[model samples]
Target: MSLLTALGVEKRPSCNVSTTAVLVESQGCRSKDLVNITACSGACSTYTLYSAKMKALEHSCSCCQEVVTSERQIQLTCKDNTEITYTYIHIDTCGCLEVDCSPFAHSETTNTPSRMRSRRRRR
Candidate 1:
């Protein structure tokens, strides 16, 4: 089973769910590495919209004063006023709030030379 399924959390298409508000309110029980935020709709809003690709820096929930990391989950408000709650899994030992892509295998063409060149040319 997938990680989400194993964790008993339903997997959504883009991590956009209604549970974000509830999670935000219960910050005390949340992990220090996780993140949670809200999205404001309408015009003249002062809060910044959340970006899925953006890495967490030093923002902390009002309820909890712990440092946010990539290993925790986050809630972000989108441009359309939608709230997205997703978990961020860290792949590297670095403490930076960034996505690590080193675990994935490199492309075959990029990692290895063409094997066809050693074969005899077609008559």
Candidate 2:
């Protein structure tokens, strides 16, 4: 039984193996137990599967020109056609992933603590 079917999802003819692979990994399915696929049927090794996921993320981030913000996020469609959400922190923390952060980096904010301290000194 395919992972989706095993999990009670109806098997659709249009769904591709790549989508299934991403869904399986993202769903936390164990790599060792690809459950339904036959052995030696060109199954992607766990390393390769995850590597592809990483590359897909990098490519998606590369194409993103939108402003990065905590409230602004991007959805990535994996080669398997499965979708995943990524936030600014998600892409920013991955130093290798390039994104424009100038807006957030240069935004001005008042120092509330210092302002409070000045008020206390005035009293």
Candidate 3:
């Protein structure tokens, strides 16, 4: 088993289930590192949005032009005494949010024609 599997942890790719939401995961250790846990716990001062307009929240993330809709903070204490925290952010994208994992994946995409073909064939 890999280190993550042995530790009861696994990393999955980011996914967007709708036009205004995305799911992502991250893991870190508390004994050797505290920053990751703190950030995931919402202790970090990241981009926050209080506006209803999607365009206004586009600058929340420096790496991409994503509009923030909501945030969920989670904290956990692992069996190994490691404190882990996870922050899940739901954002809006112009198109499909790609694997670059940043404003790349999208629930409602307008540019990819293959997306329509795939959906139609599934029926």
> Evaluated with TM-score, which candidate comes out highest?
3
TM-score of every prediction relative to native: 0.18, 0.17, 0.21
C-alpha lDDT score of every prediction, in listed order: 0.34, 0.30, 0.38
Off by over 4 Å in 1: 1-70, 91-123
**For candidate 1, lDDT tens digit of each residue in 37-62?**
33212211111223356752222111
lDDT per residue as tens, model 3, 52-121: 6665333222222343346645554565676677665544332222232234346576556776564355
Alpha-carbon RMSD to native, per candidate: 21.1, 22.8, 20.6
Better of 1 and 3 by TM-score: 3
Best-to-worst ranking by lDDT: 3, 1, 2
Q: What lDDT tens digits, residue by residue, belong to model 2 across residues 37-58?
A: 2111121111111135456322
- Winning model by lDDT: 3
lDDT at 85, model 2 = 61
